[model samples]
Target: QQQKCKQYMSAELKIPTPHSDCKTACILLGQSLKSDLMCQFENHIADFMDGLIEESMILEAAPVSAVFSSSLSDKERGKLRHLHPHSQGKQFISRRSLLDELFEVNHIRTIYHMFIAALILFILSTFVVDFIDEGRLVLDFDLLVYAFGQLPLVVCTWMCMFLSVLLVPYNLFHLWCQSQSSSHGKSRLCSWLFGSVYLIYQTLGLGFLPTYVVVTNSFPPASCFIIILEQVRLMMKTHSFIRENVPRVLTWKKDKNPAPVVPQLSQYLYFLFAPTLIYRDKYPRNPVIRWSYVATKLLQVLGCLFYTYYVFVRLCIPQFRSNSLHLFDLRAMVLCVFNSILPGVLVLLLGFFAFLHCWLNAFAEMLRFADRMFYKDWWNSTSYANYYRTWNVVVHDWLFYYVYRDFLWMSQKHFRTVALLCVFTLSAVVHEYILAVCFGFFYPVLFCLFMCFGLMFNFIVHDQRKGPIWNIFMWTSIFLGQGVIICLYSQEWYARHYCPQKESSFLDFLKPRSWSCQRPLMADS
Candidate 1:
């Protein structure tokens, strides 16, 4: 049958095809046998001819702008395609990370081994120092202990916030849906009352409770971080759940005899723990949880914690600890900034790997969440715009889908730049808020860079500028930016410690003391 099909093709083409070509044609013909064979063959021939003509035209019209524009359009389309909503009840398969898939490559594995070796060396150096100084190899973990102190309070606060988020939003949504379904005016009035009361309750539970816990308890940086981070996570989860389900409820109101499209409690509970920020009725899930993989990822997270501690102790503390503020000059500041670059970059990388990779992946494994794309190859980004979009994909997805897209909808697709600026502003404010709450200071170092310099870089160095040079520039900017943050924040932190204010005032609290701080002469001597 295959031979006959190939012979027929050759005869129709009025040519003696090669034996290998005939075999290929026969296979293609066999694959199309379920359809109308002649019709498929004719369609294939037409498509081939059309492609040839299109290629000829493209070659003739080969202008740089045209080619570049076409490529950019393709890239933009690919990104936009993912923005569309996923089909309900459809599951997707997750793809492995680039490094994970490339582990078979010797070079990739070698890099991983090198990082482990460096960690081992750091441990050895610490032990040697301890033995030499204290006459015994005693490892002190006071820093770690202090950092993670007051865990019970943090856990309790988080549980309270989670319960509010889990109960309030879902119940309020149900009330709203039921009111819409009823025709009676009393039902609508009751729904409005319930919603108003629920909003106030949420305001207290989600907003006031977390802030009160952080401020009233005088929680340390780590403890405050837990409350703030959980606060943000729960808020995003609740918003996503409502944002996704409200449209279905609205549609259900218009129908007469159909049941409401209410999602299950189990599904919402699973979503709360999933390693994603987007809400859907269903999501891609793995068939089974790999306990070994989960264990490995958790171990990596622990190693990263130690790596960060060492980075601060060796690289940051030594430089900032004993510096006399009176002797701080332009040259000294420059030196400090340059000295911090390496440590800052290390912190950035470690944080990315620790939280975005290992931490998320571990939770994903335990929860069987198959979509493991918590981040992308943001290090390879040639522009800040690309970097921001690719850096923390979980947060980016939330911001894009909820904030930016909603803004666009409100503006009726006009003023795209305004929408972009809104995203930048929201991100910068949240980041600065986190820093202020965690460190108990109002320094706007991160805010200035994120809103001002970051916004400038996003526009100036865009996706259009492609090449190795742009990539190098982007990385250099990142290094310098990180250096600035570390240098200035560290200096301010030390200055506040050494130079206690004579009297507390609002201006004094907001003002940076680093610029004016002066160490006593006897202390300096």
Candidate 2:
């Protein structure tokens, strides 16, 4: 049947026909085909010609931008193609893409945001654990070390100021050189060490400095988001070196000075200046996207329910049974667990709300300050990537535009993961420092190590390029696992370090406070 088809085609088409046995082999003009019978198949001239044209065109168009752009699948790229059918063959070039509209409807900014949300979750959970332990509701074993030992060492007054200064520049430069590197792991490790040491020194200064200096110094409050914003605003506006010479400023593209007209800029403004703007068009009519909003709201409702239940069990029920109950209420332990878990879980569930609130508020504050101060194009208003660039405006600008870029410079691959690790480590240390300063503990180092371990695990076990669900799962698992471990570790540490010895007076009772009436009468007589 094959021979007949070949003969008929050769006779009718009048084309140069390769021997049937050598068809596949004969096509290998530049490369050799080994002597395997199956490899020797004939090729029709027509199909070969068509395929050759496609290959040649692809070879001709292979530039770096083309390569990066082509990394998107054909369907993925199709969304960016000129929507107008008539616009075909004419390269459809829009400075921006509705990347959020296509596929899983995620923007690069959203992907960046998974990290941000995760960071916020980690921070809030840490706070909850601390607060619970402080209230003496739940046993936190690690609190004393974290509160007393670790933080003072990291956030010493002089050390914090010095390390902050050093870290700002070092992190900035690391981002700058990220693009040049070949091994992101090595670069990340280097940056991680440098930043960690800087933080350590900062803690040392802040911790051991003279009490006079510590008390009198006008250190900025870490909780004051506005203060951080103000500093960032001043830096962007007055500090030309940071805005210009500090490598890729985190706004849209590499060469384009951040333009307020960018979509991301508008979103940032919408989030910041007019928050209602976010809810306006985001769910104008889209059901699936709206469902996410609904899901978040549902979680909030459930969290409220749990929180209410916990309060009742811990406070109301205890009071109700106080008169009748003689033995220790076993249920109180259960209630404590619920109370701790409920509020912690609620804090996490409500995290998205806080994130949106903080981001929008922060964005507006940044823009208001940046516009009045820098007057430079400090905001970009397009793409999820640009949204990330504009919203935080500091970290994105520092890490992605600078640190990851530099990491890339030192080690060319693994830009995303390495950058992520660097940011995570810096955050863990800073948070630990904050908690340590507040409580006087060395537990932050352990916390940071635990975090780094989680990050490395995710980097190794999960393929980041996988779809949003996969990425979400990996993030959620790591964060949830870290929270659980930290809680358990803290409980154990608190039990060991902070647990009170039985009060000496309670045991000894050296003097009596009350005397019999007869003894008082005898003394008077």
Candidate 3:
């Protein structure tokens, strides 16, 4: 009926009816483009339907290939029929449209797998709970706890390996399917980064420490280095096929085509060591990666120098001899702070920046790539929002996909704020666990609570009109709250553990205009 509507519209507006020459073009354009059609026409009911009636919209939409299949003129459909060869009863769907529906639009297989995984987890958890409750799984509490605690890590490792090999290749195939002209340098880049990181970590035994005692009761060489190297070797072979074939499999227009595949392979390798993919889509032309990498290495060297200086001061210099030693008073601690935080943070920040640079560049490339090859408007009007979302998307993707998405799905519309609060709390709890493992203290829980309240408050009651000021206030409150708790908690721990009097009040430290700020000796003293 859309055809009738177009005719009605033409008559009503006194515009000439579409020429015979344009009909084939219109049909091809309509059929080849589905997303743009839906995005443009989803809300318009008049063109779509009426009660108990499906209206014929236009001359049956035909494929682009069908339009160009025959030498016949647009005035003759009968002559073109033999060359076109499409069945009259069948509806045409673009190959891109079919892949999109299966993988992107519907996510049918993903949903099915998730359901199966959830059921298995449920059953296992139930059996474990029952076994523990009945005392049938007999073991000492510590051993049992340690073994059970590893379950999540084991499951995560299994899933990562599965997805790395299976889902990654599947995503690569989608990239191949979508790339009509370009050789999909971006997709290959993503695979390289992931593969490189996986290999590096695996070679390092994922940062695990193992001890082996020799005959002389001396420590054996660290096994972690060997494991990591082995994993890296495996990964190289696993990715060899993609490394060799990607450039040849896809075609590209000459000007738009990438340099010889070797340079492209090198670029992918660069990203593998230090990912450019995250921000590559955002800022492909930027040289921030090289400078950032240099700066990080410089900081690491500086950190090592500081550490050596600290050791020299403590061991070689006399204690309490002179104020001349700036080394012990402040320089040592400054060095310690740098040694504590900078190396890891610098690497993380570099990754974050790379993610931003790559994502925007890739997105821009994607738009141009789609426009030149597909000749369809697949890019969303909310492209800016999408760019922001993809910029440093790895962590947020995990948060949204695993936690927030599931929380929202389960809760529907009810208590969304509460569900979000729980998610924050859960994140905080995991962070606290990590903190406790690294440092022999349970004090990080207070920081976790601080984050929970801050996130919940900002999310539930944020005011857009005062967004900047509101953000400042929220951040200040969280920092101050955490700072106060940490200070008090540390002082309390010190007093209880080392300071003579465990019960001294703050007032006792400031009594009766005492010339000495130090507390008086205890009665027993």
Candidate 4:
């Protein structure tokens, strides 16, 4: 633990003097307690100096940052500017995730308990239904099995993506930074050469390769979705790393350091596993791993998975497996949509809890990645803009910092609305792509919702909306939107399979099969 603190202090504080560095590391690690190392050092000073110790060696009563820079060695002060660079004054402060802190409150923990209780009810209801239908309780996971089919292919494709991302971007940056010491023409030539290669890899290697494997291999929805999601995640991480670090490298190059300082391989490796899209040499981390906390979060994720399965079995399947599945009436479509709201809302909540809350917190705990603010109180958001900002802060931070901020910086901050639109468009496209691959069909319900209604809401309901009514409106919109998503996707999923295309055409793949196809979907027995 002391070693970890020293490492963190070295990378994060960048303190030069051994005395200040060790003292600060100890203070941070032990938090408000006098450090054992400091005590030992003091004792050594007393023995070595024969009770006549020097004043310069002792840690001051003032703040570490104040005394810290005064003790900077000349070599460190000179070389420091060229290393890892980011926004000044911003530093990773070790902190708990919102949910973890919230769970300390009785009311907040009760809400969590409510979700667990719902899971219990779902399990009991599934058993009851099975007992009534089969004359004995039946345990089955046919849907789960089918969804997560083709696991081997998914694993292989993921490894390929991970390896390519792990190697390509960091190596490119390292090589490019090293080449900065060469002649101007040589550096410029190498820049284009390395930049082109990196772009090609990002597009083809990270983007297309895994997608091709997923598409051609006929992986199931769960398998395909995970592979694609991972591909995007890696791509985003690499982008953020490069965007954040490239300027730092250039700044270091300008300093004419004989050896350019790039990020360590260890830092890059940590970023890959850390539950954050942003890249930094170090993050605020915990002193020790809580295995029990990790276990609880993972178990909750598993429970949420089963809860979703039963939701599909009890609510979604029975409704979507319609008697009038062959009908193409507006009335049927409306009923399908309205009937989907409850199940769709449940799925949305379960997904948020499972992935954003449980899964992320589990990984964060294991990694001791202390900045756990993966999301916020999006449920309480009164405005669509606030909701969007708080929904998935991990993603939002990437879009805001890299996409939105960069766009504004490029455009001189005049096109704020345009930047916002760009974020929405990119998010919508990626979302639509995920759904399309998973369900094995092209449906733009979410895309339309994001681009049209979502964007409109963002403008109409700005941060000025603080009333309770606005909150009501936001939730009502969410409920309706969830209904549309589930209903359309469910219908299109069955339609694509039940009414498979005869001969391929451009319109055939683009068009919605549910609108015209006349096959009735059979409910699972």
Q: What is the lDDT of residue 166 in candidate 3?
A: 42
Runs in model 2 with CA error above 4 Å? 1-243, 246-342, 358-397, 410-424, 445-452, 464-479, 485-525
- Tens digit of per-residue lDDT, candidate 4, span 1-525: 456546544554433356666667765656423345654566676677852322222223213222111233344333333333333322344555667778999999999898778878888988998899899989979999999998887787788788888888999999898888889899999989999999999899888888888878888888888998998899999998888888887887788766656899889999999999989888878889999989999988888888899999989887867544554778887888889999999999999989998999899989999878787778888989888878897898788778777787899978878887899999999999888776767889999999999999988998878899999999999999999999888888887777788786767767898887786675642
Candidate 3 on 40-81: residue-level lDDT in tens?
474376445541132121223344223112222342333234
Error of 2 at 280 (Å): 27
Candidate 4: which pairs clash? none
Best by lDDT: 4
RMSD of each: 7.6, 18.8, 24.6, 13.3
Q: State how far residue 381 of model 1 sits from its true place (Å).
A: 1.1
- By the TM-score metric, which is better: model 1 or model 4? 1
Order candidates by TM-score, high to low: 1, 4, 2, 3
Task: Report lDDT (Cα) of residue 373, candidate 2.
Answer: 10
**Per-prediction tally of clashes:** 0, 77, 30, 0
* Residue-level lDDT for 140 in candidate 2: 36
Best candidate, TM-score: 1
Measured by TM-score, how close is model 3 to the native structure? Answer: 0.30
Positional deviation of 387 in candidate 1, in angstroms?
Answer: 1.0
